[model samples]
Target: MILLLGGTTEAKEVACCLEAAGMPYIYSTRTEVKFEGKGVSRFGALNKEGLECFCFTNRISCIINACHPFAHELHHTVAAASLNIPKIRYERGFPERAQHELVHYIKDYSEALAWTENSGFTSMLALSGVQSIPHLRSFWQKHRCWFRILDRQYSKDFASRHSFPADYLLFGLPQEKEEEVTLFQKLNPDLILTKESGLNGKLDSKIEAAIACHIPILVIEKPELPRAYKLVHSQQELLHLFQHE
Candidate 1:
């Protein structure tokens, strides 16, 4: 059995592949969003006893980890558990957009904010997820901004405590064209901030929205992690990996 540490669009695609290939596996989730493929075993956040139960009840051999990079807790604990189960982190690569000379690369969001301070963007949108709240709240609070977040409001409240405006955005992904267009119009943003979360982090629509609205973008590049295998942007390659396994 495979324990798929799922929470991204790529997780669903992987599930599709698993079903098509006729494999049985478990899909773990903390949110209400249902995975695409059926016949998946379900589990939520596993406690210590729960982990013991999981280890005892199943012959789980491989873990298909699809959680985001910033989700260090999930990756560290579940992905690094003491079992015979080998883990393959579905890594996220960079987007294919052409880099202009104007686009700057920084280590993380704090540096990104430092670079932007007083330089003045027409407007800014933060899509780095909640992990980026410290940099945004502490430094980039004065800018015209919007932030997409889950229901927890972790990032939003943090930003609020640090004097960020209360009227910022709280949203989700894979938006349609009209929705993107609507956001583009509503924000009238000139700069878009995002992370490099590859295929699973489905921000393609948002990118299209920004480009369609002629807005420039800022990206928080993905930080490299150990023991993670990156899948090339082709299924043939993925199949080759599976075959070698």
Candidate 2:
């Protein structure tokens, strides 16, 4: 049996591939998001030791890691736990960095926040998600900022727990370029912030909207994955691994 670590859209793609191949697997997620795809669904965060125990108890022979690129800690935990098993990293294809004058790419959250502080952006729109609320607390506390989060109670409660202004939270995902432009016009923020979440994350739309509104945008680049796992970019590539087995 395979243990599939999933959370991103790529995870669902991986699950679909597995189902098509008639493979038995367990899809694990850190959150309680609905998984309509075929697989035995499980949810909860697990540490390295816990992961090893679960793998052993479940008779997991292979591991498919279709997690978000920025899930750095979980990547390490999976690598550590899958010492004697085959681990596959189903990575998403990222677009080339936008070279527009309004596009500024930062290394990570800390640096992104540092740039925001020194850049004199009075009002900002954050497309980075709910988890970033605490990371950018210093800037939001002092400036006029808004965060776009999932329209779920869990996300709202998370922002509330972080003491972020309820009124400042914008729900839902990134929209088409035209809709995004309308939102940008309405918000009229001094700056826009987002992550390098690839095509599935609708990064292009966000950048286009920011450019249309003549607003400077900051992009937090995706972090590097662990060298321990084998990486594949497509469903065919992932399924090909099991062809000889």
Candidate 3:
């Protein structure tokens, strides 16, 4: 059985490929999602011991990791657990449009905050999501910050629990460059903060808006994942890997 750690779009594609190939597999996600794949699926996180037990019990022959790029901890856990079993990392290709002069890339959130402190920026609109709120809290106390979170009950609850001011929160991801431009005009922010979520996260729209407003945008670079048996950047490569391996 193949153990497919799936959550991203690539994961869904991989599941579809596996189904068509008539390959026995188990799909797993960190959280419960509305999965349409007609195969065995499991929800919830698994520690090293738990993963090892699952691999052993299910006779897992291979592991295909198709998780979010910024899922650092999960990546380490998966790499550690796949020492004996063959593992392939299905990563999304970086968006070609991310290359530009106005876009400043930083190593991590801490660096982003440090740079913000030195840059003399007063107000910022963060498109980096809810996970960034805690790190930006101190920065927020000193300057104006608007955190855009998903329009979901869980996201709202999490933000509320963190005591993020209701007024400082913006819901929903911007679907178009014009929508982002409208936000920039209304906020008149000194800076825009985001993560390198690649093309899938619609980072281009954010960049376009920032450029239109002549605002500098700071991006937290995606962390490197551990080297696996195979690393594939597209669905075709992933499917080809399964065929050869």
Candidate 4:
């Protein structure tokens, strides 16, 4: 049996493939985002102890990590938990490095905030999600900047605590290229801030949005992990690894 600690589409696909292959497996997700399959389990918060319990309970041998980037702590915990259990990470291909000559790439959020403020970006769109809000709040409060987030994910106090103007667009985005262009036209933002959540999270929409808006994007780079096996964007490679073993 295989234990998959996952929350992405890729993870769901892998779980489906494993099930079709007649392999027993369990899929773990922090949210109730439904995946079509039999015998798939969901966990609101997955931790090391829970992982061990699941593995032992099911007599599973291998652990698959389908979590996206910024799940650094989860990655380490999984690695440490598996002394005898083999672990595999289902990673999509990295983003194509399309260098924007006008855009500046920062090492982390702090650097991105500092550079955006120092660069005199009077108005900015904080599409880095609610997670990036705290870091940017200080500058926004002092600068009287503008930003937006999903109304479903955050509270009314979210903007109040941060001292930024709160307005809920509640706009549902389409995944088409032309639709992205239309959304970009609607936003008319001067700048966009986002993370490198690989290609799974409608990332192409963001890049296309930035292009259509003719604005610069501040992408937070992923860190180099320690003592890890890496792959270069190949599902066939992943298939081979799982199939041969």
- Residue 232 in model 4: lDDT: 23
The candidate 2 region of ten consecutive residues with least summed lDDT is 236-245
At residue 9, give the lDDT of candidate 2. Answer: 89
Candidates 1 and 2 compared by lDDT, better number: 2
- Where is model 4 more than 4 Å wrong at Cα? 142-174, 229-235
Each model's TM-score, in the order given?
Answer: 0.72, 0.97, 0.91, 0.81
- Cα lDDT tens digits for candidate 1, 98-143: 4554344457777677666646654677777765666676445555
Count clashing pairs, candidate 1: 0
| Model 2 CA deviation exceeding 4 Å by range | none
- Model 3 alpha-carbon drift over 4 Å, by segment: 97-101
What's the ranking of the predictions by lDDT, best on top? 2, 3, 4, 1
Judging by TM-score, tell me the better candidate of 2 and 3: 2
Deviation in angstroms for 32 in model 2? 0.9
Q: What is the lDDT of candidate 4?
A: 0.66
Error of 4 at 180 (Å): 3.1
For candidate 3, give the lDDT of residue 234. Answer: 74
lDDT values, one for every candidate? 0.65, 0.90, 0.85, 0.66
The alpha-carbon RMSD values of the candidates against the true structure, listed in the order shown, are 4.2, 1.2, 1.9, 3.3
Put down candidate 4 lDDT per residue, 23-109, tens digits, no spaces. Answer: 777777765565667756867775778777778888888877777676777787777775476677777656675576545567887
